[model samples]
Target: MMPVDANVKKIIAQPLTAEAFQKYGQVVSVPRGDDGQSANNNTAKRFNFLGNVQNLRSDAKANMCVFRCQPVAMPFHMRMLEKHQYSNQMFSPMNAQRYLVIVSLGGDEPDLQTLAAFVADGTQAINYNAGCWHHPMIALDTTIDFTCFVHENGTKDDCTVTQTKEQFFVHI
Candidate 1:
Protein backbone atom coordinates (compact mmCIF):
# COMPACT_ATOMS: atom_id res chain seq x y z
CA MET A 1 0.00 0.00 0.00
CA MET A 2 1.16 3.54 -0.57
CA PRO A 3 2.45 5.53 2.37
CA VAL A 4 -0.09 7.56 4.39
CA ASP A 5 1.09 10.77 2.76
CA ALA A 6 1.01 9.20 -0.69
CA ASN A 7 -2.68 8.23 -0.40
CA VAL A 8 -3.70 11.61 0.95
CA LYS A 9 -4.81 13.89 -1.89
CA LYS A 10 -5.22 17.64 -1.73
CA ILE A 11 -8.99 18.43 -1.62
CA ILE A 12 -10.23 20.78 -4.34
CA ALA A 13 -12.46 23.73 -3.39
CA GLN A 14 -15.83 23.64 -5.18
CA PRO A 15 -19.04 25.63 -4.71
CA LEU A 16 -22.76 24.94 -5.22
CA THR A 17 -24.11 27.43 -7.72
CA ALA A 18 -26.42 27.43 -10.71
CA GLU A 19 -23.39 26.77 -12.90
CA ALA A 20 -21.90 24.23 -10.51
CA PHE A 21 -25.22 22.85 -9.27
CA GLN A 22 -25.77 19.52 -10.96
CA LYS A 23 -29.44 19.12 -9.99
CA TYR A 24 -31.88 21.65 -11.42
CA GLY A 25 -34.67 22.92 -9.15
CA GLN A 26 -36.04 25.94 -7.33
CA VAL A 27 -33.22 26.37 -4.82
CA VAL A 28 -34.27 26.67 -1.21
CA SER A 29 -31.77 28.19 1.17
CA VAL A 30 -31.73 26.04 4.25
CA PRO A 31 -31.35 28.76 6.82
CA ARG A 32 -28.50 28.12 9.18
CA GLY A 33 -28.97 29.38 12.73
CA ASP A 34 -26.63 31.86 14.40
CA ASP A 35 -22.95 31.23 13.81
CA GLY A 36 -22.07 30.87 17.50
CA GLN A 37 -25.08 28.61 18.02
CA SER A 38 -23.62 25.78 15.96
CA ALA A 39 -21.84 23.19 18.08
CA ASN A 40 -18.22 22.70 17.16
CA ASN A 41 -15.91 19.81 17.91
CA ASN A 42 -12.77 18.10 16.67
CA THR A 43 -14.63 15.38 14.77
CA ALA A 44 -17.14 17.66 12.98
CA LYS A 45 -19.80 20.28 13.34
CA ARG A 46 -23.59 19.65 13.47
CA PHE A 47 -26.47 21.86 12.37
CA ASN A 48 -30.21 21.65 11.78
CA PHE A 49 -30.79 22.40 8.09
CA LEU A 50 -34.39 23.26 8.84
CA GLY A 51 -36.70 24.14 11.69
CA ASN A 52 -37.51 21.47 14.31
CA VAL A 53 -40.96 19.91 14.66
CA GLN A 54 -42.87 16.89 15.98
CA ASN A 55 -43.78 13.93 13.73
CA LEU A 56 -44.30 10.17 13.71
CA ARG A 57 -42.87 7.19 11.87
CA SER A 58 -44.66 4.76 9.59
CA ASP A 59 -44.08 2.43 6.65
CA ALA A 60 -41.22 2.84 4.17
CA LYS A 61 -40.88 6.20 2.42
CA ALA A 62 -39.99 7.14 -1.16
CA ASN A 63 -38.37 10.58 -1.14
CA MET A 64 -34.88 12.07 -1.48
CA CYS A 65 -32.84 14.79 0.16
CA VAL A 66 -29.54 15.84 -1.36
CA PHE A 67 -26.90 18.38 -0.46
CA ARG A 68 -23.58 19.57 -1.84
CA CYS A 69 -20.15 19.44 -0.20
CA GLN A 70 -17.21 21.71 -0.82
CA PRO A 71 -13.59 21.80 0.22
CA VAL A 72 -12.44 24.54 2.59
CA ALA A 73 -8.69 23.99 2.90
CA MET A 74 -7.76 27.45 4.08
CA PRO A 75 -8.11 26.20 7.67
CA PHE A 76 -5.36 23.61 7.37
CA HIS A 77 -1.76 24.05 6.29
CA MET A 78 -1.60 20.48 5.00
CA ARG A 79 -4.42 18.80 3.07
CA MET A 80 -5.99 15.57 4.38
CA LEU A 81 -8.28 12.84 3.15
CA GLU A 82 -12.07 13.47 3.25
CA LYS A 83 -13.82 10.99 5.51
CA HIS A 84 -17.51 9.96 5.42
CA GLN A 85 -20.16 7.66 6.95
CA TYR A 86 -23.35 6.13 5.46
CA SER A 87 -26.52 4.17 6.17
CA ASN A 88 -28.18 1.23 4.40
CA GLN A 89 -31.55 2.92 3.78
CA MET A 90 -32.94 6.13 2.32
CA PHE A 91 -35.29 8.52 4.22
CA SER A 92 -37.65 10.69 2.27
CA PRO A 93 -41.19 12.17 1.97
CA MET A 94 -42.13 11.96 5.65
CA ASN A 95 -39.27 10.92 7.90
CA ALA A 96 -36.81 12.80 10.04
CA GLN A 97 -33.37 11.88 8.74
CA ARG A 98 -30.12 13.71 9.22
CA TYR A 99 -26.51 13.58 8.06
CA LEU A 100 -23.47 15.38 9.40
CA VAL A 101 -20.21 16.27 7.66
CA ILE A 102 -16.84 17.82 8.42
CA VAL A 103 -15.96 20.14 5.59
CA SER A 104 -12.35 21.09 4.83
CA LEU A 105 -12.27 23.89 7.38
CA GLY A 106 -8.68 24.30 6.22
CA GLY A 107 -8.19 27.83 4.92
CA ASP A 108 -6.44 26.96 1.69
CA GLU A 109 -7.13 26.27 -1.97
CA PRO A 110 -7.08 22.92 -3.76
CA ASP A 111 -6.07 22.36 -7.36
CA LEU A 112 -8.57 21.58 -10.13
CA GLN A 113 -7.00 18.19 -10.74
CA THR A 114 -7.90 17.18 -7.19
CA LEU A 115 -11.56 18.08 -7.74
CA ALA A 116 -11.69 16.15 -11.03
CA ALA A 117 -12.32 13.00 -9.04
CA PHE A 118 -15.42 14.50 -7.35
CA VAL A 119 -18.26 15.88 -9.40
CA ALA A 120 -22.06 15.45 -9.77
CA ASP A 121 -23.23 16.18 -13.29
CA GLY A 122 -27.03 15.82 -12.85
CA THR A 123 -28.28 15.64 -9.27
CA GLN A 124 -30.14 17.82 -6.74
CA ALA A 125 -27.61 19.01 -4.16
CA ILE A 126 -26.42 21.85 -1.94
CA ASN A 127 -22.65 21.86 -2.33
CA TYR A 128 -20.45 21.96 0.74
CA ASN A 129 -16.99 22.94 -0.50
CA ALA A 130 -15.09 21.93 2.59
CA GLY A 131 -12.61 19.82 0.66
CA CYS A 132 -12.65 17.27 3.47
CA TRP A 133 -14.42 14.02 2.74
CA HIS A 134 -17.49 13.32 4.88
CA HIS A 135 -20.06 10.71 5.79
CA PRO A 136 -22.31 9.81 2.82
CA MET A 137 -25.51 9.70 4.89
CA ILE A 138 -26.68 9.24 8.46
CA ALA A 139 -30.35 9.18 7.43
CA LEU A 140 -33.29 11.04 8.99
CA ASP A 141 -33.32 12.85 12.29
CA THR A 142 -36.94 14.15 12.21
CA THR A 143 -39.65 14.37 9.59
CA ILE A 144 -38.78 16.88 6.87
CA ASP A 145 -39.91 17.84 3.34
CA PHE A 146 -37.44 16.81 0.63
CA THR A 147 -37.49 16.17 -3.12
CA CYS A 148 -34.81 14.86 -5.50
CA PHE A 149 -34.09 12.52 -8.40
CA VAL A 150 -33.83 8.74 -8.13
CA HIS A 151 -31.96 6.32 -10.41
CA GLU A 152 -34.70 3.78 -11.14
CA ASN A 153 -32.60 1.35 -13.22
CA GLY A 154 -31.08 0.20 -9.91
CA THR A 155 -27.59 0.57 -11.36
CA LYS A 156 -26.94 3.75 -9.37
CA ASP A 157 -23.25 4.62 -9.09
CA ASP A 158 -20.88 7.02 -7.35
CA CYS A 159 -17.32 7.48 -8.54
CA THR A 160 -16.28 4.98 -5.70
CA VAL A 161 -15.69 4.62 -2.03
CA THR A 162 -11.96 4.98 -1.45
CA GLN A 163 -11.97 4.45 2.32
CA THR A 164 -9.19 5.64 4.57
CA LYS A 165 -8.73 6.48 8.25
CA GLU A 166 -7.62 10.11 8.29
CA GLN A 167 -8.25 12.24 11.42
CA PHE A 168 -8.57 16.02 11.21
CA PHE A 169 -8.18 18.51 14.06
CA VAL A 170 -10.04 21.83 13.81
CA HIS A 171 -9.09 24.56 16.26
CA ILE A 172 -11.83 26.94 17.30
Candidate 2:
Protein backbone atom coordinates (compact mmCIF):
# COMPACT_ATOMS: atom_id res chain seq x y z
CA MET A 1 0.00 0.00 0.00
CA MET A 2 1.18 3.49 -0.71
CA PRO A 3 1.94 5.68 2.23
CA VAL A 4 -0.25 8.68 2.93
CA ASP A 5 0.97 12.00 1.63
CA ALA A 6 3.03 14.19 3.89
CA ASN A 7 -0.01 16.47 4.00
CA VAL A 8 -2.76 13.93 4.18
CA LYS A 9 -6.33 15.09 3.88
CA LYS A 10 -7.61 15.58 7.40
CA ILE A 11 -11.37 15.74 7.76
CA ILE A 12 -12.82 16.86 11.05
CA ALA A 13 -15.96 15.01 12.03
CA GLN A 14 -18.97 17.28 12.28
CA PRO A 15 -22.35 16.73 13.87
CA LEU A 16 -24.64 15.01 11.40
CA THR A 17 -27.41 17.45 10.60
CA ALA A 18 -30.01 17.04 7.89
CA GLU A 19 -29.02 20.27 6.19
CA ALA A 20 -25.34 19.47 6.25
CA PHE A 21 -25.84 15.90 5.05
CA GLN A 22 -28.53 16.70 2.48
CA LYS A 23 -26.33 16.55 -0.59
CA TYR A 24 -25.13 13.07 0.20
CA GLY A 25 -28.29 11.57 1.65
CA GLN A 26 -31.13 11.95 4.11
CA VAL A 27 -30.68 12.00 7.86
CA VAL A 28 -33.28 9.63 9.25
CA SER A 29 -34.50 10.70 12.65
CA VAL A 30 -37.69 11.34 14.51
CA PRO A 31 -38.68 14.78 13.36
CA ARG A 32 -40.12 17.42 15.63
CA GLY A 33 -43.89 17.64 15.82
CA ASP A 34 -43.90 20.70 13.60
CA ASP A 35 -41.76 18.99 11.01
CA GLY A 36 -43.15 15.47 11.21
CA GLN A 37 -46.20 13.65 12.45
CA SER A 38 -47.36 10.67 14.50
CA ALA A 39 -48.44 7.52 12.73
CA ASN A 40 -49.79 4.06 13.62
CA ASN A 41 -52.19 5.38 16.25
CA ASN A 42 -49.60 7.81 17.67
CA THR A 43 -47.37 4.89 18.66
CA ALA A 44 -44.64 6.03 16.28
CA LYS A 45 -43.16 9.31 15.06
CA ARG A 46 -42.69 9.38 11.35
CA PHE A 47 -40.14 11.21 9.24
CA ASN A 48 -41.39 10.35 5.87
CA PHE A 49 -39.87 10.33 2.36
CA LEU A 50 -36.31 10.15 3.55
CA GLY A 51 -34.53 8.89 0.45
CA ASN A 52 -35.11 7.36 -2.91
CA VAL A 53 -34.42 3.67 -3.32
CA GLN A 54 -33.32 3.79 -6.93
CA ASN A 55 -32.96 0.44 -8.65
CA LEU A 56 -32.91 1.25 -12.33
CA ARG A 57 -31.68 -2.12 -13.42
CA SER A 58 -34.06 -5.02 -13.90
CA ASP A 59 -32.18 -7.45 -11.69
CA ALA A 60 -32.01 -5.18 -8.65
CA LYS A 61 -33.99 -6.04 -5.52
CA ALA A 62 -34.55 -4.25 -2.25
CA ASN A 63 -33.91 -6.15 0.97
CA MET A 64 -33.33 -5.60 4.65
CA CYS A 65 -30.52 -6.97 6.80
CA VAL A 66 -28.98 -6.49 10.19
CA PHE A 67 -25.30 -5.66 10.43
CA ARG A 68 -23.33 -6.24 13.60
CA CYS A 69 -20.32 -3.97 13.43
CA GLN A 70 -17.38 -3.62 15.76
CA PRO A 71 -16.16 -0.29 16.98
CA VAL A 72 -13.52 1.64 15.07
CA ALA A 73 -11.33 3.90 17.10
CA MET A 74 -10.47 7.43 16.08
CA PRO A 75 -7.42 8.47 14.06
CA PHE A 76 -7.96 5.52 11.74
CA HIS A 77 -6.69 5.60 8.20
CA MET A 78 -9.19 5.23 5.35
CA ARG A 79 -7.97 3.78 2.08
CA MET A 80 -11.05 2.78 0.20
CA LEU A 81 -14.58 3.97 -0.56
CA GLU A 82 -17.55 2.30 -2.15
CA LYS A 83 -20.71 3.18 -4.08
CA HIS A 84 -23.87 1.37 -4.96
CA GLN A 85 -24.85 2.26 -8.49
CA TYR A 86 -28.17 0.49 -8.54
CA SER A 87 -29.70 1.53 -5.23
CA ASN A 88 -29.65 3.69 -2.16
CA GLN A 89 -28.35 2.28 1.14
CA MET A 90 -29.81 3.11 4.53
CA PHE A 91 -28.45 2.37 8.01
CA SER A 92 -30.26 2.83 11.28
CA PRO A 93 -28.79 1.70 14.56
CA MET A 94 -30.68 -0.86 16.58
CA ASN A 95 -28.82 0.26 19.69
CA ALA A 96 -28.25 3.72 21.01
CA GLN A 97 -24.67 4.73 20.12
CA ARG A 98 -22.62 7.12 18.06
CA TYR A 99 -20.92 6.25 14.79
CA LEU A 100 -18.91 7.74 11.95
CA VAL A 101 -20.25 8.46 8.50
CA ILE A 102 -17.78 9.29 5.73
CA VAL A 103 -18.78 10.34 2.25
CA SER A 104 -17.51 11.94 -0.95
CA LEU A 105 -19.28 13.30 -3.98
CA GLY A 106 -18.44 13.17 -7.69
CA GLY A 107 -20.83 10.74 -9.26
CA ASP A 108 -19.69 7.13 -9.78
CA GLU A 109 -15.99 7.91 -9.30
CA PRO A 110 -15.51 10.29 -6.43
CA ASP A 111 -12.60 12.60 -5.91
CA LEU A 112 -10.69 11.91 -2.74
CA GLN A 113 -10.33 15.60 -2.04
CA THR A 114 -14.09 15.88 -1.61
CA LEU A 115 -14.22 13.45 1.28
CA ALA A 116 -16.06 14.55 4.42
CA ALA A 117 -16.85 12.86 7.72
CA PHE A 118 -19.78 13.27 10.08
CA VAL A 119 -20.59 11.89 13.52
CA ALA A 120 -24.12 10.55 13.90
CA ASP A 121 -25.59 10.03 17.32
CA GLY A 122 -27.73 6.97 18.02
CA THR A 123 -30.88 8.96 17.44
CA GLN A 124 -29.91 9.52 13.83
CA ALA A 125 -29.68 7.29 10.80
CA ILE A 126 -28.54 7.92 7.21
CA ASN A 127 -29.56 6.95 3.72
CA TYR A 128 -26.92 7.13 1.02
CA ASN A 129 -28.26 8.09 -2.36
CA ALA A 130 -27.52 5.81 -5.25
CA GLY A 131 -23.99 6.16 -6.68
CA CYS A 132 -22.73 8.20 -3.76
CA TRP A 133 -19.27 7.23 -2.49
CA HIS A 134 -18.95 6.35 1.17
CA HIS A 135 -16.79 4.46 3.61
CA PRO A 136 -18.02 1.25 5.11
CA MET A 137 -19.70 1.25 8.54
CA ILE A 138 -17.66 2.72 11.39
CA ALA A 139 -19.18 2.20 14.78
CA LEU A 140 -17.75 4.21 17.62
CA ASP A 141 -17.49 3.49 21.37
CA THR A 142 -19.23 0.09 21.24
CA THR A 143 -20.41 -2.68 18.99
CA ILE A 144 -23.64 -1.80 17.17
CA ASP A 145 -26.33 -3.55 15.24
CA PHE A 146 -27.76 -1.59 12.31
CA THR A 147 -30.90 -2.27 10.33
CA CYS A 148 -29.86 -1.80 6.72
CA PHE A 149 -31.98 -1.31 3.61
CA VAL A 150 -30.30 -1.82 0.28
CA HIS A 151 -30.75 -3.10 -3.25
CA GLU A 152 -28.75 -6.08 -4.37
CA ASN A 153 -28.66 -8.71 -7.08
CA GLY A 154 -25.83 -10.94 -5.90
CA THR A 155 -23.44 -9.45 -8.43
CA LYS A 156 -20.28 -7.37 -8.49
CA ASP A 157 -22.24 -4.56 -10.08
CA ASP A 158 -24.08 -4.09 -6.82
CA CYS A 159 -21.10 -2.11 -5.57
CA THR A 160 -18.02 -0.38 -6.90
CA VAL A 161 -14.97 0.24 -4.77
CA THR A 162 -12.19 2.73 -5.23
CA GLN A 163 -8.92 2.33 -3.36
CA THR A 164 -6.65 5.22 -2.67
CA LYS A 165 -2.96 5.00 -3.41
CA GLU A 166 -2.47 7.04 -0.28
CA GLN A 167 -4.18 6.78 3.09
CA PHE A 168 -6.35 9.38 4.74
CA PHE A 169 -7.01 9.43 8.46
CA VAL A 170 -10.07 11.00 10.03
CA HIS A 171 -9.92 13.25 13.07
CA ILE A 172 -12.72 14.49 15.25
Candidate 3:
Protein backbone atom coordinates (compact mmCIF):
# COMPACT_ATOMS: atom_id res chain seq x y z
CA MET A 1 0.00 0.00 0.00
CA MET A 2 1.04 3.58 -0.60
CA PRO A 3 0.53 6.75 1.42
CA VAL A 4 -2.50 8.83 0.51
CA ASP A 5 -2.80 12.51 -0.17
CA ALA A 6 -4.92 14.41 2.35
CA ASN A 7 -7.09 15.97 -0.34
CA VAL A 8 -7.15 13.06 -2.76
CA LYS A 9 -10.00 10.64 -3.06
CA LYS A 10 -8.97 7.04 -3.52
CA ILE A 11 -10.97 4.91 -5.94
CA ILE A 12 -10.71 1.19 -6.53
CA ALA A 13 -11.55 0.34 -10.12
CA GLN A 14 -14.13 -2.38 -10.61
CA PRO A 15 -14.41 -4.59 -13.68
CA LEU A 16 -16.31 -2.86 -16.46
CA THR A 17 -19.78 -4.21 -17.13
CA ALA A 18 -22.64 -3.19 -19.41
CA GLU A 19 -25.29 -3.04 -16.69
CA ALA A 20 -23.13 -1.07 -14.30
CA PHE A 21 -22.00 1.43 -16.94
CA GLN A 22 -25.34 2.09 -18.66
CA LYS A 23 -25.86 5.58 -17.24
CA TYR A 24 -22.62 6.89 -18.63
CA GLY A 25 -22.32 4.84 -21.76
CA GLN A 26 -22.49 1.48 -23.46
CA VAL A 27 -20.02 -1.36 -23.21
CA VAL A 28 -19.21 -2.84 -26.59
CA SER A 29 -17.94 -6.33 -27.25
CA VAL A 30 -18.69 -9.44 -29.20
CA PRO A 31 -22.23 -10.43 -28.32
CA ARG A 32 -23.29 -13.90 -27.19
CA GLY A 33 -24.12 -16.41 -29.91
CA ASP A 34 -27.83 -15.75 -29.79
CA ASP A 35 -27.29 -11.99 -29.85
CA GLY A 36 -25.40 -11.99 -33.15
CA GLN A 37 -25.67 -13.47 -36.61
CA SER A 38 -23.17 -15.18 -38.82
CA ALA A 39 -21.88 -13.17 -41.73
CA ASN A 40 -19.58 -13.57 -44.73
CA ASN A 41 -20.78 -17.11 -45.25
CA ASN A 42 -20.20 -17.98 -41.62
CA THR A 43 -16.63 -16.78 -41.76
CA ALA A 44 -17.42 -13.87 -39.42
CA LYS A 45 -20.03 -12.81 -36.87
CA ARG A 46 -21.90 -9.52 -36.76
CA PHE A 47 -23.38 -7.94 -33.67
CA ASN A 48 -26.00 -5.44 -34.61
CA PHE A 49 -26.78 -2.18 -32.77
CA LEU A 50 -24.32 -2.46 -29.94
CA GLY A 51 -24.40 1.31 -29.48
CA ASN A 52 -25.48 4.48 -31.25
CA VAL A 53 -23.41 7.56 -31.98
CA GLN A 54 -25.14 10.62 -30.58
CA ASN A 55 -24.39 13.45 -32.97
CA LEU A 56 -26.83 16.03 -31.67
CA ARG A 57 -25.77 19.13 -33.53
CA SER A 58 -26.65 19.69 -37.14
CA ASP A 59 -23.16 20.86 -37.94
CA ALA A 60 -21.34 18.13 -36.11
CA LYS A 61 -19.32 15.72 -38.22
CA ALA A 62 -18.28 12.27 -37.17
CA ASN A 63 -14.59 11.66 -36.84
CA MET A 64 -12.56 8.53 -36.34
CA CYS A 65 -9.01 8.76 -35.12
CA VAL A 66 -6.25 6.53 -33.87
CA PHE A 67 -4.50 7.59 -30.68
CA ARG A 68 -1.26 6.04 -29.61
CA CYS A 69 -1.43 6.51 -25.88
CA GLN A 70 1.34 6.15 -23.38
CA PRO A 71 0.97 4.20 -20.20
CA VAL A 72 0.12 6.09 -17.06
CA ALA A 73 2.36 5.89 -14.06
CA MET A 74 0.68 4.66 -10.90
CA PRO A 75 -0.76 5.66 -8.55
CA PHE A 76 -2.84 7.66 -11.02
CA HIS A 77 -4.17 11.05 -10.03
CA MET A 78 -7.33 12.29 -11.75
CA ARG A 79 -7.52 16.06 -11.78
CA MET A 80 -10.16 16.83 -14.35
CA LEU A 81 -12.95 15.47 -16.50
CA GLU A 82 -14.30 16.27 -19.95
CA LYS A 83 -17.54 15.90 -21.88
CA HIS A 84 -19.08 16.48 -25.26
CA GLN A 85 -22.44 18.11 -24.81
CA TYR A 86 -23.55 17.53 -28.39
CA SER A 87 -22.10 14.14 -29.21
CA ASN A 88 -21.16 10.76 -27.88
CA GLN A 89 -17.59 9.43 -27.85
CA MET A 90 -16.28 5.94 -28.42
CA PHE A 91 -12.92 4.23 -27.90
CA SER A 92 -11.87 0.80 -29.10
CA PRO A 93 -8.53 -0.63 -28.18
CA MET A 94 -6.45 -1.69 -31.13
CA ASN A 95 -3.61 -3.07 -29.05
CA ALA A 96 -4.21 -2.21 -25.45
CA GLN A 97 -3.80 -4.53 -22.50
CA ARG A 98 -5.86 -2.92 -19.74
CA TYR A 99 -7.12 0.61 -19.23
CA LEU A 100 -9.03 2.83 -16.84
CA VAL A 101 -12.39 4.44 -17.45
CA ILE A 102 -13.54 7.01 -14.90
CA VAL A 103 -16.85 8.77 -15.13
CA SER A 104 -19.43 10.76 -13.15
CA LEU A 105 -22.99 12.01 -13.70
CA GLY A 106 -24.26 15.47 -12.88
CA GLY A 107 -25.94 18.58 -14.32
CA ASP A 108 -23.12 20.92 -15.38
CA GLU A 109 -20.31 19.65 -13.22
CA PRO A 110 -19.34 16.16 -12.24
CA ASP A 111 -20.88 14.75 -9.05
CA LEU A 112 -17.96 13.39 -7.15
CA GLN A 113 -20.29 11.31 -5.04
CA THR A 114 -21.35 9.56 -8.21
CA LEU A 115 -17.80 9.03 -9.41
CA ALA A 116 -17.11 5.56 -10.70
CA ALA A 117 -13.95 3.90 -11.94
CA PHE A 118 -13.81 0.84 -14.16
CA VAL A 119 -10.98 -1.33 -15.40
CA ALA A 120 -11.43 -2.50 -18.96
CA ASP A 121 -9.67 -5.38 -20.60
CA GLY A 122 -8.30 -5.23 -24.14
CA THR A 123 -11.38 -6.67 -25.79
CA GLN A 124 -13.83 -4.19 -24.28
CA ALA A 125 -14.72 -0.83 -25.79
CA ILE A 126 -16.79 2.02 -24.36
CA ASN A 127 -19.12 4.59 -25.89
CA TYR A 128 -19.99 7.56 -23.75
CA ASN A 129 -23.40 9.20 -23.99
CA ALA A 130 -23.64 12.85 -24.86
CA GLY A 131 -22.83 15.14 -21.91
CA CYS A 132 -21.41 12.34 -19.83
CA TRP A 133 -18.36 13.43 -17.86
CA HIS A 134 -15.33 11.19 -18.14
CA HIS A 135 -11.63 11.22 -17.53
CA PRO A 136 -9.27 10.71 -20.46
CA MET A 137 -8.27 7.14 -21.24
CA ILE A 138 -5.51 5.88 -18.96
CA ALA A 139 -3.61 3.02 -20.49
CA LEU A 140 -2.04 0.51 -18.19
CA ASP A 141 1.00 -1.81 -18.48
CA THR A 142 2.05 -0.66 -21.96
CA THR A 143 1.48 1.92 -24.63
CA ILE A 144 -1.68 1.34 -26.64
CA ASP A 145 -3.16 2.36 -29.96
CA PHE A 146 -6.85 3.12 -29.60
CA THR A 147 -9.35 3.87 -32.31
CA CYS A 148 -11.47 6.80 -31.12
CA PHE A 149 -14.77 8.15 -32.46
CA VAL A 150 -16.51 11.45 -31.87
CA HIS A 151 -18.48 14.24 -33.51
CA GLU A 152 -16.99 17.68 -33.87
CA ASN A 153 -17.71 21.05 -35.51
CA GLY A 154 -14.59 22.93 -34.51
CA THR A 155 -16.43 24.64 -31.68
CA LYS A 156 -15.83 24.87 -27.96
CA ASP A 157 -18.86 22.68 -27.36
CA ASP A 158 -17.01 19.86 -29.04
CA CYS A 159 -15.50 19.22 -25.64
CA THR A 160 -15.80 20.77 -22.20
CA VAL A 161 -13.32 20.18 -19.44
CA THR A 162 -13.70 20.85 -15.76
CA GLN A 163 -11.06 20.63 -13.10
CA THR A 164 -12.12 19.13 -9.84
CA LYS A 165 -11.54 20.92 -6.55
CA GLU A 166 -10.53 17.64 -4.97
CA GLN A 167 -8.52 15.26 -7.10
CA PHE A 168 -9.05 11.52 -7.12
CA PHE A 169 -6.37 8.85 -7.03
CA VAL A 170 -6.83 5.42 -8.54
CA HIS A 171 -5.20 2.28 -7.17
CA ILE A 172 -5.71 -0.97 -9.05
Which candidate tops TM-score?
Answer: 3
lDDT score, candidate 1: 0.29
The RMSD of every model to the true structure, in order and in angstroms, is: 14.9, 2.3, 1.8
Each candidate structure's count of clashing pairs: 39, 0, 0
TM-score of each: 0.25, 0.90, 0.94
Query: Candidate 2 residues 21-53, lDDT tens each?
Result: 988889988765555677889897666676667
Poorest 10 consecutive residues of model 2 by lDDT?
1-10
Model 1 bad stretches (over 4 Å): 1-4, 21-146, 153-172
Relative to the true structure, candidate 2 reaches a TM of 0.90
Query: Candidate 3 lDDT, tens digit per residue, 1-172?
Result: 3467687789999999999999999999986565578899999878888987898999989999988889998778888999999999999999858999999998789888989999999999999999999998889889988899999999898999999878888878
Give the runs in model 2 whose Cα sits over 4 Å from its true position.
1-7, 33-35
Displacement of the residue 68 alpha carbon in candidate 3, Å: 1.3
lDDT, candidate 2, residue 103? 93
Order of the predicted models by TM-score, top scorer first: 3, 2, 1
User: Which TM-score value belongs to model 1?
Assistant: 0.25
